[model samples]
Target chain A: MSAAKKTALCAMLCAVSAVLSTLESALPLPVFFVPGCRLGLSNLAVITAIPLVGAAGSLSVVAVKSLLILVTRGVTAGIMSISGGLLSLAVMLLLFRLARFGFVGVSVASAAAHNTAQLAAAGLLMGDVRVFSFWWLYLLLSIAAGALTGVAAGVIIPPLGRALGAR
Target chain B: MKKLSKTPLFAAADIFIIALVLALAAVPFFISVKGAGAPLSASVKINGRDAGSYPLDNAGEFKLVGENGIEMTLVVDGDGVFVKDSSCRDKICERTGKITREGQSVICMPGRISIALEGETGGADAVVG
Candidate 1:
C-alpha cells in the first residue's frame, strides 16, 4: 500500500476501534458484571486490519486507541488499556499468520490474552496480586466476547475487502 | 495473514479453546472463593484512605464519613462486616449485605467507602500473652 493509503487505512481503523470501545462502555451489559471485564469490541477493527494493513499499521491502530483512552480516562486507565490492547493485537496477528486457528478460536485466544494482561497490569498497579482473584471470571467471559467479535469480524471483513480491495 | 476461511465461524478448535480457557479461569476463582484464612478483623477505607480497623469478635456498629460528607453505618457482627445504613442514594453498600471471609469487601462507590473483612494471618492463629 502507498504511504497516503496506509495512513488513511490506519486512521480509519483507529477511529473505528475508538468508536466501538466508546459504544461498548456506554452500554452497561450485565455480561461485564465481573470486575475487569469488557466485551473487547475494539478488537474487531484490529483483527480486520491484520489482513488489510501490515503489522506496523495495525500496531498504530492499537496505539491510537490507547492514546485516545489515556486522554479521556486517566493515566492509570491508559496504561491498563495499552498493555491489554497490545498483547491482544499481537496474539491475534500470530494466530492469523498461523492460518490454523479459525475465527472464533483466534478471537477467543486474543480476548483471553487481553484479559490476562489487564489482570496482570491491575495487580501490579495496585501492588496486590490478590486482584487476580477476578482472573477466572474474566477469562470465562472472554470466550463469549471473543466469539461475538469473531462473528462480527467474519461478517464485516469479506464485504470490506471486496469494497476496498483490502488484500 | 491467511485467506479468510469460508468455513463456519465456529470450528472444532474453537470448542477446544473455549474449554481450555474455561478450565484455566476456574482454578483461581474456586481458590479465591475457598478463602484459606478465617475472618479476624474489619478494615474500613474511605476513598483509598484507611478510616479505621476493628476486630470482628463482638457485635458493633459505627458511622463512616466519606467524601462529600457521605455517612454510612457499618455493622460488625459474628457473621462479618456490612453496611447497615448509608446516606448515599444508591445504597449499594447496604445491598452488598455481609462479608464474612478474607478479601471480602462491602463497597459504597458513591461514598468511596469500603468495609473489608481481614482474615487470620495464618491458617492457625497464635495466642500471645
Candidate 2:
C-alpha cells in the first residue's frame, strides 16, 4: 500500500477503536464473576494494527485512543485506560513476533494482558494490593472475549489486507 | 554447523512470562474467597435530594430515582452491584453488577445515576473529606 493509504487506514482503525472504547465504557457489562471489567472492543483495532503497521503503528493507535479518552474523560479513568492499552500493545507485539498462532492467539493474549495491566495500575494508584483480587475472573473474561474479537478480526483483515494490498 | 540452529532463549522467556501472568490472575479467586460481610452503608442522594440509604443488612436491594422520572432498584451481593430493574431502553446499568467493596462503582449513563463504594477516604471509619 502507498504511504498515504497506509496512514489513512491506520487513522481509520484508531478512530474506530476510540469509538468502541467510549461506547463500551458507557455500557458496562454485568459480569457474574468480575464486577468492574468490560470487553474492551477497541483492542481489536490494536491487535489488527500489529500485523499491518507493525509495532510503531500499533503503539501509535493505542496512544491516539488513550489520548482521546483522556482528553474527553478525566485523569483517573484515562490513566487506567492508557496503562491497559500500552500493556496490551506490548504483549501483542511480542507474541506477534514469536508465534504464528494467528490472530486468535494474539487477541486472547492481548486481552489478558489488558486486564492484568489495568488491575496492576489500579493497585499501584490506590496503594493497596487487594485491588488485584479481581484478576482471575476478569482475565478469563478477557481471554474469551479477546478470542471472539480476534476471530472476527481474522476473518475481516484478510479481505481488507488483500484489497489494500497490505504486505 | 547444523547444531547452531537453536531457537532463541527469548521465546522460552515469553512462554514463562505468559504462564506467570495466568497464574497471578488465578490468585484472586483463592484470596478473596472469604465472604466479606457488608462493609458499607450510606445514603444515596441525587442533586442534593434524598433518594434513599442503602441498607447494610441486605446489601442486595436499594432504590434510586433516574433522570427520566423513573425509579431503579439496585442489588449488591458478594460478587458485585447491578440494576435489578430500570425504565431505560438500554439495560446497560443492569448489566454492570452490584459493587459492595470499596473502589467499585456501577453507573447508569442515561439516568445520570451512580452508586459507588466509597474508598477509604472517610466514613464511620474515618473523618469525611
Candidate 3:
C-alpha cells in the first residue's frame, strides 16, 4: 500500500474505533465485578489495524482515538485513554512482530496491558496505592474481557485482512 | 511463511498466557478467602493519608472530607458498613453497595476517599505483584 493510502486507512480505522468505543460504553453489560469495566470492543479495530498498517499506523489510530476522547471528555479521561492505548499498542506490536503470536495472544495481552496502564495512571494521579488492592479483580476482568475481544478479533481479522489486502 | 492447514484460535503461547493470568487472578482470592471469617474493620483514608478506622461491630456514621473538600458519609448499620452518601458527581461509592466481607471496599475515586475492610489475611499480600 502507498503511504497516502495507509494514512487514509489509519484515519478510517480511528473513526471506526472511536465509534466502537462510544457504542460499547452505551452497553449495559451484566458486569458487577468492576464498575467501570467494559468488554473492550473498541480494541477490535486496533488489533486489526496492527497487521494492516504497521505499528506507526496503529499508533496514529491510537492517537486519533485518544484525541477524540480528549475533546469529548475531560483531561483525566484523555490521559487515561492515551496511556492505555499507547501501552497496549506497544505490547501488541511486540508480540505480533517479534514473538510471531497469533492475533488472539496479541490482542489479549494488549487488553490486559491497557487495563494495567490505566490502573497505574489512576494510582499515580491520585497518589494512592490502595488502587492496587483491586488489582486481582481488575486483572481478572481485563484478561477475561481481553480474551473475549481477542476471540472476536480472531474470528473477524482473517476475512477482514483478505478484504483489505493486509498482511 | 509456512501455510498451516487451519488458523488455530489459541496457540501454545495463548494457553500459557491464559493460565498465567488465571493463576495471578486466583492467588489473592485464595489468600483473602482463608481469612474470610476475620473481624470487619473500616479503614478510612482521605487523599491517600490514613484518616481513621472504626470497627463495624458498633453501628454508627462518620463524615470524611477529602483534600478536595468532597464530603462522604459512611454508615455502619446492622450487618455491614457502606457509603450512605457522597458529594462527588457520580455516586459510585454510594452505589458500590454494602461491603460486608474481608478485603472488600468502597472507593470514591472522584472524592479521593477509600473505605476498605481490614482483613486478617492482609498486610501487603495483595500488593506483591
Candidate 4:
C-alpha cells in the first residue's frame, strides 16, 4: 500500500474502533458475574489492522480511539484507556511478530494484556496491591472474556481485512 | 507480517487456550465455595479506606459518608447487603442488586464506595484498598 493509502486505512480503522468503543461503553452489559467487564469488540479493528498495516498502524488506531474516549469521557477514563490500550497493542504486536501465534492467539494475548494493564492502573491509583487480591475474580473472568472476544476478532478480521486489502 | 489464512474457527491452539481458561476458572469456584452454612458478612469502604463491616444476616439500613461528602445508603437483609441509594449521578452501585455469594461486590465509582461480601470460611476479607 502507498503511504497515502496506508494513512487512509489507518484513519478508517481508527474511526471504526472509536465507534465500537463508544457503543460498547454505552450499552448495558448483561454480564452479572463481572459487573464492569466488557466484550472488547473494538479490538476487532486493531487485530485486523495488525496483519495488514503492521504494528505502527495498530498503535495509531489505539491512539486515536483513546483520544476520542478521553474527549468524550474524562481524564481518568482516558488515562485508563491509554494504559490498557498501549500495553495490549504492544502485546499483540509481540505475539504476532515473534510468537507466530495465529489471529486467535494474538487476540487472546491482547485481551489478557488489556485487562491486566487496567488492573495495574487501578492498583496504582489506589496505592495498594491488595486491590488486585480483592478483584481476583476478574482475572479468571478476563481469560474467559478474552477467549470469547478473541474468537469474535478472529471471525471478523478476515472479511474486514479483505475489504481493506490488508490481508 | 504473515498473510492471513482461512483456518478452522476452533484451531488446536485455540482449544488449548480455552481448556486452560476453563481450568483456571474452576479453581476460583473450588477455592471460594465450601461449607455453605458459614455466616456471610459485607465490608464497606470509601476511597480505599475502611468504612465499616456489617453482617449479611442483619436487617437494617445505614448511611456511609465518603471523602468528597458523598453519601451512600446501605441496606442489609437475609438476602445480602446492597446499596439502596447513593448521591452519585449514575447510581450503578444501587442497581447492582443484592450480593449474596462470597467475593461479590457492589462498587460505586463516582462515590468511591465499595461493598464486598465477607465469607466466614476465612476467605480473605474484601476491601477496596
lDDT of 4 by residue, B10-113 (tens): 45665555455456546656665553545887887777777788887778998987645678889989878888768865566676678787667777654566
For residues A1-167, what per-residue lDDT tens digits would candidate 4 score against the true structure? 67898888888899989988989988857773465577788888887778777888889999998898789876656777898899989887776666445556666667767877876776565443334433456656666666676778777777766776654
TM-score of every model versus the real structure: 0.76, 0.63, 0.84, 0.79
Candidate 1 local lDDT, residue B21: 93
Q: Candidate 2: which stretches are off by over 4 Å? A: A30-34, B1-23, B29-129
- Name the best candidate (by TM-score): 3
Question: RMSD in Å for candidate 1, one decimal?
Answer: 5.0
lDDT, candidate 4, residue B111? 57
Interface RMSD computed for candidate 4 is what? 3.6
Better of 1 and 4 by lDDT: 1
For model 2, the docking class works out as incorrect
Q: In order, what is each prediction's RMSD in angstroms?
A: 5.0, 8.4, 4.4, 4.8
- For each candidate, what's the DockQ? 0.34, 0.10, 0.34, 0.26
Task: Indicate the residue-level lDDT of A13 in model 4.
Answer: 91
Candidate 2, after superposition: displacement of residue B88 in Å? 19
Q: What does candidate 4 score in Cα RMSD to the true structure? A: 4.8
CA lDDT scores, all candidates in order:
0.75, 0.64, 0.75, 0.71
Candidate 3 chain B, run of 10 with poorest lDDT: B1-10
True contacts kept of each: 0.43, 0.09, 0.30, 0.18
For model 2, what TM-score does chain A reach?
0.92
Better of 1 and 2 by lDDT: 1
lDDT of 1 by residue, A24-43 (tens): 77765765555335688899
